[model samples]
Target chain A: MPRPAVEFWFEFASTYSYLSVMRIERVAEAAGVEVAWKPFLLGPVFLALGWNDSPFNIYPPKGRYMWRDLERLAMKEGLPFHRPSRFPRNGLLAARVALVGVEAGWVAPFARAVMTANFAEDREIGEAAVIEDILRALGLPADEVMARAQADANKLALRCQTERAAELGLFGAPSFRVGEELFWGNDRLEDALAWACAGAA
Target chain B: MPRPAVEFWFEFASTYSYLSVMRIERVAEAAGVEVAWKPFLLGPVFLALGWNDSPFNIYPPKGRYMWRDLERLAMKEGLPFHRPSRFPRNGLLAARVALVGVEAGWVAPFARAVMTANFAEDREIGEAAVIEDILRALGLPADEVMARAQADANKLALRCQTERAAELGLFGAPSFRVGEELFWGNDRLEDALAWACAGAA
Candidate 1:
């Protein structure tokens, strides 16, 4: 029988997504659960909900609590966290590159590197140069991959993937889907894996 | 030195707040942390957020997930849960009565009973009769307490408490504050107690 599996739906601009991407691999491997890395845009999702920007920005208190919560959570995980000057920095370019990386079997490493660069080093992952640097560091052909990522077909594929996410009733990042069971937020990672494992039975 | 303490800020109509209310006292007791129950209304908070109704009502997907999450969580705790017909029943009267309970040293029981009635019994907690029933169950004078709860001073006091919650940057229910460190959501109860204990040092 095939191993139990979960689709990890994440957005590059999501703070909780950064937390999940950094640690999901080890946990998934330990649980014998296959990880399907799904990089999608939250922009369209928010727009559908009548939010022109991240809810964190639209609601200042939630935004403030989120940054502090992220910092505390990162510290507990021993992961370096630096608040970016820009909130919800365009993850468009990074998501595109991550799609390329997902197909190249370097999704985990590439996603983690991008998150670290953006969240820890205060670097912008939205820039094509930053994404190119991430791809090159992974020993992939940056020029070829970048060209393929920006191709009309690949762009359309990402759009369809995001639409699928919306159809799945996803309204936030770092969501996990185990079969038909959906677990939202970074805090639900464990619960999602447990659901997947239970389903395997 | 006195034991470390944390204030548990909750709303009667909040689904997650029900979960936290049911479990927090035992957890706090086990951790040797003192808990200060602070019941406040989320109506004002949401209004200040420019939302006329609960975000769950505005966002169907989120609302759907919250109910499912609450049911699952409630079952895990061996607690009964029935979905109330109303999304967010009027918590105004309950909050006012809770303030009265706070001074009478019956805050925890009063809050838990109201949550159970709303989430587990499908009762309308907004009704004065329901609040009176809960108060009488606690052996408090239902008529007198209900009358005192509606006094102009008590009404204004509840308003002040909600305003204080807003000033503290609260955006959601079931929040915990250990001095200035705020932990939001039911999942953070354990962490909040830990933070309180650490602060005692």
Candidate 2:
């Protein structure tokens, strides 16, 4: 039987998604599960719920604890983590670029590289230069990818993806979808993989 | 110099708190840090934010992932876990009773016992009989505790604590405060302890 696949629905600006992006492939492979990278924007989703910004920033104590917790978790996982000065960075371009990559079958690698740049290296992902450099390093045509990312069709597709996520009852980033079952957060990666494996069985 | 203490601010109904409550003592002891249990209710905090129920329930994907993640984490930590049927159960009584125990200096054990009953035994904590049994098992006056829990002053105190939590900018349950440094969630327990111990130096 062909292995059932889990769709890893992620946003470029999500911190936990960075961790999952870096590790999900290896983790899923070890567990004998297939992963499909689904890049989408969380901005519209948050706005739909009347949130003007990330909930972590709106709630200070939770935000404070999240940073400290991330530090500990990063250390435990041996992943680099530094709080980016510009949080809730505009992820529209990144999402559009990811959409293009998905068409080109480079979605996973592009997502991982972007996540590493945003979370591990603490780079300003909103800067087109940085993203272009990431694309160039990946041997993709930077100008072509950027042009596609700015195209009206790509933008519309990104919006449609966001709407789809909301329709699926996803209010947060770093969510996973296996058939109709939706799992949220990097912590749920294991369960999502397990569910996908079970479906294969 | 007196060793600085880390305040473990927890909600009695928080599942993550159950894991921390069971293991914090040993972890803190090994790190040579004093842990002060600060029992508080998350209900008022939620209400103040215009939320009618647990964010988990309001956001189904996040809620579903949280339960599954909790199970995986419990297994990793070698702890027992069973999802309670009545989630977000009326924790008012539990919190009030915990406040009473804190005043009487039995907060730690009482907190552990109650958590065990809720998560380990999967008991309906909203039930008066179950709470009474827990209180009796702890060698406390069940009737007296229940009565005190309902008193106007205790109710006011609970409100005050929730207000203080908001004033402190807390967003969720299972937060920790080490001196002036606040760390939120079970994930930050180690950092909280380390910060507390460092302050002692």
Candidate 3:
């Protein structure tokens, strides 16, 4: 029989996504569940809600609370987290490169490295050099991967993937999906995995 | 030293607040913590953010996900939950009467009753009769309490409490505060209590 699977829908620029990406593999593996790393942009989803940027940026108080909350949560989780110099740094290039990783079976490490660089190290994820360095560090072919990720076909594939997220009624990340059930935010990770392990019964 | 205390800032109309209200006292008692229930309005807070109504109402997709999430969470918590016919039924009257309950030393039960009526029973909390019913059921003087709750002085007090919440940078309901630290959402209840017990060290 096939292992129970859960789709982890995340946006690279989402703080909560950073938390989920850093630890999902360990938890899913322990629970004997398979995880599919689905990278998608929250920009378009926010635009559909009449927001031009992360809601955390659009609302000052929420933004302040979010950073403090992240700091506390990261400390509790024993993870290194630094408030990025730029809020919602463009994840366009990183997300596209993530798709390339997904196809090559290296999505987990590449995605975690990107998140660590953007959030913990305050690097610009949108820059090609940053992404290429991450790829090269993983012993992957950087130039070839970048070229493939930038292709019209790969770009269209990412767009279609985001549309699927919208169709599933997702407005935030990191969201978890098992069959028809959708769980939003990093806090719901365990519940989603448990549901997946239950085989949707 | 006195038992560690935490202020639970909540709005009567918040769905997550319903979840928190149902079980906070038990958990707080077991954790050797003191909880001060502060009933405040979210309407003013949303207004400050240029929203005329609940953000859940303004954002349709979010609103949709919230109800489903509430249902699943409530079920898991062994709490009965019904989707109220109205979204964010005006908690103005309820908040005011709750202050009267606070004075009479019936705050906890009165506040929990209001939440139960709105969420588990699908009742309209905005109506005076409903408030009267809840107050009377608790063996409190319904007419006198309602009259006092309507007085200009009492109304002003509730308004001031809501303003205090905003001053503290609270942007939503079911938020817990321990000194300078603020924990938002129902998921953080235990963490907030733990922080309070740790005495801000």
Candidate 4:
């Protein structure tokens, strides 16, 4: 019998995604479930919804509340957080690199490092230098991975993955897919794991 | 000393509100916290954001996911649920009656009944007849409560409460306020209760 699994769809720049990326592995392992890491861009998804910017930035009141809510949630989860100096930093390069990690079996740690850089360490994950630093810190071949990550094929692959997310009816990141069921937000991680284990929840 | 309490701001028309309304009391009591029931309107709050309809209705994908998510959540909690034929039945009348209950000290039960009627029974919560039936089921004088709920003073109170919701920077329902900190969504209910108990989190 195949191990029950879930597809984790995440974007590097999403605050909520930061929460899930930081903890999904532990949660899934505890639930005895398997995970397929999927790195995708939310920019195209939001653009298709006619949003030129992150909805958090577009709606001020919601944006205000979200920052405070994220802070509280991070504290509760024992995670470090620093508000990003910039909102919705371009995740195109980081996502493409994550796509490279996906094939090489190191996506989870790489995604966590990138998320920590963007959300907790106040570093820009959009530039090659920052991403290269993350790659080297992971003791991976920075030169080789960076070359493949920036290649046209890897870039195209990230775009296709994003398109697949759209086709799956994803509107937000840190989303989980178990069969046809889709669970959105960092809060639903546990529920998605339960669905994965039980096949119905 | 006053019992540590959190203010629950909710709207009768909201699907997520149905989940919170039914479960808040049990959760709060378990945490040794008190709950102050707040019945407010989301229509005006959304209107201020230039949304004339429910964000779910305006955004097709989010709307599509919400109904399914709500069903799963309801099932998990052992709460009865049926998809309402109408997306957002005018919650005006129900909210007004809830305001009356707030003063009369029956708001919690009243809110739960209305929520059940709206989400579980597929009743039209907007109509006086449906609301009146709920009121009578609670053993209240339907005629007197309806009269008072519709009185100009009570109507003004609901308006002021909604304005307060906006002033407090609420863009959504099932919100909990612990003094200055505001927690949004039913998922945050437990966290909000913790804040009430700890005073800071």
Clashes (N, CA, C under 3 Å) per candidate = 0, 1, 0, 0
Give per-model CA RMSD.
Answer: 1.1, 4.2, 1.2, 1.4
What would the per-residue lDDT of candidate 4 be over residues B1-201, giving only the tens digit for each residue?
A: 668899999999999999999998898898888888899999999999989999999999999999999999999999999999998989999899988898899999999999898898899888888988988899999999999998999999999999999999999998999999899999989888888888733
Candidate 2 lDDT score relative to the true structure: 0.82
After superposition on all CA atoms, how large is the RMSD of candidate 4? 1.4
> Ten consecutive residues with minimal summed lDDT in candidate 3 chain A?
A192-201
lDDT of 1 by residue, A4-104 (tens): 99999999999999999999999999998999999999999999999999999998999999999999999999999999989889988788888978888
Range of the 10 consecutive residues with the lowest summed lDDT in candidate 2 chain B: B59-68
lDDT tens readout by residue for model 3, B11-102? 89999999998889999999988888899999989899889988888999899989999999999999999899888899999999988777
In order of appearance, the predictions have TM-scores of 0.98, 0.77, 0.98, 0.98
Residues B19-92, candidate 1: write the lDDT tens digits: 99999989999999999989999999989999899989989999988888888788879988999988789999
Per-residue lDDT over A173-197 for candidate 2, one digit per residue giving the tens place of the 0 to 100 score: 7888888877777767887888888
Candidate 4 lDDT over A92-164, as tens digits, reads 9999999999999999999999999999999988989999999999999999998999899988899899999
Candidate 3 residue spans exceeding 4 A from truth: none
Give the Å shift of residue A49 in candidate 4.
Answer: 1.0
lDDT of 3 at A19: 96
Give Cα distance to truth, residue A176, candidate 4, Å: 0.4
Error of 3 at A12 (Å): 0.9
As a TM-score, model 2 comes out at: 0.77
